[model samples]
Target: MSGPAPLPAPYALDDVDQALVHALQIAPRADWTRIGSVLGLDAVTVARRWNRLTEAGAAWISCHPAPVLAAAGQGLLAFVEVDCANGSLLDVARALAALPHVTAVEHVSGDGDLLVTVLAPDLVALTHWVTRGLGSMPGISATRTHLASTVYTEGSRWRLRALDRGQIARLADGEPARGEVPVFPLTDLDHDLIAVLSVDGRATYRALAESSGASPDTVRRRLGRLFAAGMLQTRCEVARPLSEWPVAVVYWGRVAAGALESVSRLVTGVREVRLCAGVTGRHNLLVVAWVKSLADAQRFEVRLNERAPGLEITDRAVVLWLMKVSGHLLDERGYRIGAVPFDVRAAARTAPTER
Candidate 1:
């Protein structure tokens, strides 16, 4: 057999590239013409840049079932710390990265060799996955799982902050309002629609209709309702090497249950925090941030300590490599070579109360 695929060369983005990425993060599916107007570039030029980024695996757009959908008893989310036999870490990480439900897998420096974030249709499925599915895998010596009780912020919310107010306003002008609406249970069609989006967040109504077998009008109406109900979220992700902030760090902290909400809100407001959640474990709060370099980690910690005096950071780990993120598996070069679309509807069918 041939050796593994060659890693893509390291790419450093310039100011224009960074600005374009920031625009996509703010409005992931905006038309190229509109983005061009805001950035004062031709629509063709904007689209060409995006094409280059995606082709290089420097950036991509993906859709995820909103955390509110899980919190509403439709699915289960958990963070699992895994210990592997000395020589099996890479093997184990690659295996986990291939699973549809395991959104992120990072080789870290901490109590475990790998940290895995898992999503399932419900608690029963989650429990089964942890106890049976993961337990049966080779090389995994031990595992400690923490169920995410509340997701105050997800990576999707983090923006590069490279665009100015006028540019941001221009991009947001016709964006759909993403707010909480009455909970209308997702239908089979909705599940199919989400599956389509999981691969291409910017897929048009006509494209979605073709894939999901719904009329364009039905797709449009359903998508609007889902967005309004806070059951769907879109994110623009770029390769770390292509981003201004390349270093990623994870923080495990302890905060009293009573202070968890306030502390979460505080941390989420920090521009560095890409994910902030309350998990069930000794360290109740988990924070993930992307920064410019190693030194920025210390600075961020200091700021975090000052902002939330009561929060105690027990452990911090720098991510050496990200094998997978969301449903896309990455090569060492950070190019998306394969995908296992997230299927939350499968989990929703097995709804078991959180333990």
Candidate 2:
């Protein structure tokens, strides 16, 4: 008998996988044919690799309302810090993860036991969600909520930087044209498309048509219009454990008057800065990042101090557990399993109805 087959090689994010993810990050819905061309590989090979990635839950493509909506007061975004009763952190994290409005749940190092990022349609909905929605939960806790005034950069902007300039340029082929942010409302069809894309941003026009009951051509035009209007954004995400940067941290910062906008712009340039926004809180700025280790988290602060002296880190939280990201529930090991579609017009799409 043939010797027992040698064990399969260890799974890892090899250079090729990184390149593929990098390409997708630049052009989230780029076809395999185009991405394959950029990577100098066969389209079939690229498609096979992508299938493996998604099947293993090592990566996924998801969509959410563009941050512009939050900034323009057309949608709501807030970060909530929660202090759970003794020994309820993990349970609370899982419970919070199931809430669609709670787009992200992170157990971090701070006085607070958990940090949750919430999305809603307006202030009233957000208040109700935070007060009645969360307050009614079993875990006993006090909560502090900070609303984002400006989103300089967020998860969708973070990239692996695994590909060179030329590769990225080729991958970004036929990028959609962007115009002034539309100061208007999205139609019911837009919401339908968004709900579908939230689960799979890479869905083909035909698939979107079938799911949303719009013709492929209509889906294309509406998607273009929504994009141009800055109503939605799509992103490719790799599971954290498979990434070079595994350690996550949240930084609460304060900046000098008249410097919030400029300083935020500068800080967001750091590749590790997954999120940098101006918020209404004692610490007016919020930054979230992923690094290689706890030591690297400190190094990030050092680099920040050197690069932007005006930004003061008032508080720091080393993420102990990241239960969810971008509406996708993750296992303890940080692999995507299922998604909670973010509804653009409602408080939350998947939340249970309150009595």
Candidate 3:
């Protein structure tokens, strides 16, 4: 039996590109001057390289820390397995791509036809979605879901890596960071501090100090140093169930590299589309749409097919279960520092109800 195929990628990257990614993972806000200083280049050169990466669609800059906002019962981690009908491989993939919680989707070469990850607020909501919503679709032979127990990693790090020295060239006047980038060893103090922060992002320095066996002053200084060195960031995860929406659907499709922007625009144009991003393996451009019920999932699919022709479709694997999710990924020390406030602002201006 044939299995799912690799999804389309907007561009290809080289080793230097890989290195650039590594460096950025370490410091998203690192200025061109600092980057150029280390790489023996100038600010203009740093900008050009970054532009190249973005233009190629090999990378994107985003602040994705919503996972931290999710409280225990507020969200679910799900894995979906999909079965297709009548050589409709591409069609099925396109349909699933449209789902809102289907953050990661892949057309695979394996026992199952397709795999997907979904997020919702509760089990009752998820049950209604699969049984009445997605299950009603034609050609969907079967769907299974696995709910996540704990998340090992989340946010930008899951998809992006830090840029390394090889990938960067310093600006003509830029200076390198003092000393070899110090890799802070995970000390007992570090671990103790992390333990406290993991429980409460806003915990006071005094409390952290008392728990970590460090003086209050020392704790403050260490945290400051960590923040400056780009070893930490603060973020929260937020999650709501699919049933809360009036409509939900998985819109999926495969397009030529040239048509990515058009499809992305079309996909995001719809109000229901919640999350959309490319993945490392196949089944790129995974999307999730939120709506009231299954009927909405169908209507969106029809419109999507008409909007983008020639794009292949795959299976729409209804989410059944989620295995593990680590609400957030702290540094090796498991602590985050210097992160901006959770910006629910992007969607706020347009969709007042969404957060």
TM-score winner between 1 and 3, please give it: 1
CA lDDT of each candidate?
0.83, 0.82, 0.47
Query: Could you tell me how far off, in angstroms, the CA of residue 49 lies in candidate 3 after the best superposition?
Result: 1.1
For all predicted structures, in order, the TM-scores are 0.92, 0.92, 0.42
Taking the tens digit of each residue's C-alpha lDDT, what string does model 2 give over 104-180?
A: 98888879998988888888888877767677777747889999888889998889899998888776656776556
lDDT of 3 by residue, 1-355 (tens): 1112212333234545554544554445467676666555687876688666443323434332233223324445456677777787556655554343444445544356666565554666666566665566666688766554433233433212224345433321232242233435434565466445543454678887888788999998776655544344433221112113423344444556677666666665555565554332345455555555567667666776676554555545332211111222111111211121222111112211111
What CA RMSD would you report for each candidate? 3.7, 4.4, 17.9
Give lDDT tens digits, candidate 1, residues 1-355.
1123433565467788889989999888889998888889999999999888776667788888888877788878899999999898888887787666678898888778999988887787887777777767788899999999999999888887789999998888868887757667888898888877877888999999998888999999999999888798889988877676788999999998898898888989888889999998788999999888999899989999999887999999998888788777776655566666777644333321223
- Candidate 1 clashes between residue pairs 3 or more apart in a chain or in different chains: 121-347, 121-348
